[model samples]
Target chain A: MTFVNVGTLGTQPGQREAVVAILTRANPQLAQAGCLLYEVGTSEESPDTVFVTELWTSAEAHQESLQLPSVREAIAEAMPLLNGQMSGFQYQISGSPLRD
Target chain B: MTFVNVGTLGTQPGQREAVVAILTRANPQLAQAGCLLYEVGTSEESPDTVFVTELWTSAEAHQESLQLPSVREAIAEAMPLLNGQMSGFQYQISGSPLRD
Candidate 1:
């Protein structure tokens, strides 16, 4: 089943753009790891937060990606920029109008 | 520039599956209207809420889609199944490494 992860990363004042940069950086490894879609954006309503939406082949693909060296490095690079206020939710994709 | 919308719709008790059904029904009209991605999902963290993530060629495309008869009809069908709680955020694409 396809797994979806939607979440926000809260950054310290003025650190939002930096986090967005890190998360949005190109990494071919993501697709090889089963990522279908990986989007990083910033919302007008929440200037301090960066919004991310991801689609993976499976829940396991997402979990295993966390242990990847490059992913770990990216997380390390982004952690300090964060404010520790993160909120998100994950789900298995049941369907899509276009895909159906 | 790409436009992204990430949001959640809170459904009436036990109406989640129904709402999901409505949101995920096949709609080729969405693509003709410039929708790149339109995903409907449900999260374990918030059982009553349905998550939606969308990507559009432009913000204008998304706004215009609302005026579409099919889109309006879909909204009407979904409104009653909802519990009046909705939270979402929209953003204009800055950049993405994958897309870059």
Candidate 2:
């Protein structure tokens, strides 16, 4: 089963784009570590909220990626732009096109 | 551009599986109407919460899908299983492997 991460990041007013830039630049490095999909998006309903949807080979892989220096650096950069309000859930992918 | 729907559906007790079944059965019908991806998952952190992650060709395609008879029927069936605490966001895909 694939591990899925779906979360919301609340950013300061006008800072969502900057946070997204860091995440966007970090994707290639993340993909090399078993990230099948990593999507970052901005909500139409909430301008300051950013949504990150990810698919990884396993929970361990996701954890391992976080420990990578590049990922750590990216997180450090994004931290200041965040408003400290974050909500997310982890799941085992039960159904998806990739499975088919 | 792709429109993404990432939402949480809170089920009544063990009703999460039942809700997932309805959504799973409705997938093929949804795909026929331009749904690129429709993934349904149950959160590991919250057993009663179901996450629906979808990618549509456009917001219009997604809107048109809601009018389909089969889709309407499925929603009606799933409603009774819901706890009425639904939270979701509509996003414009900013970065994703699909775009690459």
Candidate 3:
């Protein structure tokens, strides 16, 4: 089954740019891997909160991405920029997961 | 290669049961469709917030689910039970969409 991870990035005040920068620098490396989609965007309702959504070919692939040197470094660099808690869940694609 | 829709369901106070009830009622019907993975769960930190994550075989499948008579009816029935705005985004599974 395909795996997906849904999470949020809580950026500290005035640190949005740095967080995005970290993502920008990290995306290409992530894209080069087994990651099918690795994207980060701002929440429409909450500017301080960022939405991160991903789809991986397999659960193993998802686990491997965490070890990427660049991925870890970039995220570590952005850690100080965060304000609130970042959380996520893993799922096995079942069917059409949307309504419309 | 695959399409994913990430969104949330905002249930009004004391209406969590109504929302889950709605989803519980609609899931079997959703599973009968082209949906590959369809499930709902509560957030670990915020009991009031619900997180929905789905991976559809295609965007078309995602759209079709909306038209399902039961699906539509269920979501509509649960509308009044919502407290905050529910929003989502669509993505093409790019790679392994996660870190280890």
Candidate 4:
């Protein structure tokens, strides 16, 4: 089953773009580390939040990713731009939405 | 630009699978209405919450989908299975995380 982690990082006022920039730039080692998808997004409705939807090979694969230097570096860069407010959900894919 | 709507649906006790069945079965009109993806998931961590990640051609297309008979019927059927609890984020995709 694929492991999905979807969440938001609340940014400091006017810092959402900077945070998003750092996020989208982080990918060199991700694919090698079992990342299947890492989609980044933002919204006009939620100016201070950056949304992410990720798919990983497994929950363990996702946890191990945090120790990679590239991920750690990216987190360091994005940390200061954030407000420490976060919310999300984790799920092991249950089924395909389309039967076909 | 893809319009993304991702959220969690709180299922009534032990009704998660029933709710998931209805969601995954809703595909006849979705693709024609501009749905790119409709991923349904459930988590062991949050047993009662069903997570969804959707990609639509536009927010308007997603809005219009609710008017479809398939969608309307699905919503009506799943309503009773839900606990009236929901949480999610709406965002416009910014960019691919891979800078290449």
Using DockQ, give the best candidate's number.
1
Question: Which structure among the candidates has the greatest lDDT?
Answer: 1
The better candidate by lDDT, 2 or 4, is: 4
lDDT of 4: 0.87
Note the chain A TM-score of all models in turn: 0.96, 0.90, 0.82, 0.95
lDDT of 2 by residue, B1-100 (tens): 7888778899999999888887777356677888987888886678898888888988899899999898898899999999999987777778863344
Which rank order by DockQ, best down to worst?
1, 4, 2, 3
The digit string of per-residue lDDT tens for model 4 on A1-100 reads 7888889999999999998898888486888888888889899888999999888899999999999998999899899999999998888887655546
Model 3 DockQ, alpha carbons vs. true complex:
0.13
Model 4 alpha-carbon drift over 4 Å, by segment: none
- CA shift of B72, model 1, Å: 0.7
Show where candidate 2 strays beyond 4 Å.
A97-100, B97-100
Order the candidate numbers by TM-score, best to worst: 4, 1, 2, 3
Candidate 4, residue B37: how far the Cα is off, in Å: 1.8
By summed lDDT, which 10 consecutive residues of candidate 4 chain A come out lowest?
A91-100
List chain B TM-scores, each candidate: 0.96, 0.90, 0.80, 0.94
lDDT of 3 by residue, B1-100 (tens): 4566677766787776557656655356665666665555554444555556766777788888899888788778888888867766555543332332
Q: What is the DockQ of the complex in model 2?
A: 0.48
Give the Cα-based TM-score of candidate 4 against the true structure.
0.93
Candidate 4 has a DockQ of: 0.65
> For residue B14, what is the lDDT in candidate 3?
71
